[model samples]
Target: MTIDEQTVDKIAHLARLELGAQEKQDMIADMNKILGFMDKLNEVDTTGVEPLIYMTDEPNTLREDVIKQEITTAEALSNAPDHDGSHFLVAKVIK
Candidate 1:
């Protein structure tokens, strides 16, 4: 399919883009070239080629999950900028 100025204008409008007359003409030419290349690609024969799913053959590796000791309340609150004994304090967000 060939791209024309009208098609370029429609595409630009749909994409919310502002293009000048020269830019619209340039875009039409560029789009036509791209479509021409795609048309050439369509001429290639691939009768029995299997569609690719994954690029690599290796399976995903996973690590075993193990139970671990949880940090104490004091340890968890150690990095707080302002804390009231066991809980963090912050400025009131609601009126």
Candidate 2:
């Protein structure tokens, strides 16, 4: 519909924005222009047109994930400076 200064002021207030007299007037004209453009778009006939999506027919062409067996615990703990049995020992962080 038509945008007025009062409508623009209400919108600005709702959005927690402060607009001066000139700014409010500018917003009204800009909003009316936007609404008029939308109205023009509404005149087009596209009843059977499908909604647009992000992608086309291109495949991902990604490689499959290769599952390898994990290393033994002893092999992992071998590099550690301090280890009790299963996990590495470090200084207590929490007090």
* Candidate 1 lDDT tens digits, 21-60: 8898889889998999999989989789887899888997
Candidate 2 similarity to native, TM-score = 0.57
lDDT of each: 0.90, 0.90
Error of 1 at 44 (Å): 0.3
Weakest 10 consecutive residues of candidate 2 by summed lDDT: 51-60
lDDT (Cα, tens digit) per residue for candidate 2, span 1-95: 89988888789989999999899888988999999999999999989998877578687789899998699889989999999879999999999
Instruction: Work out the TM-score per prediction.
Output: 0.60, 0.57
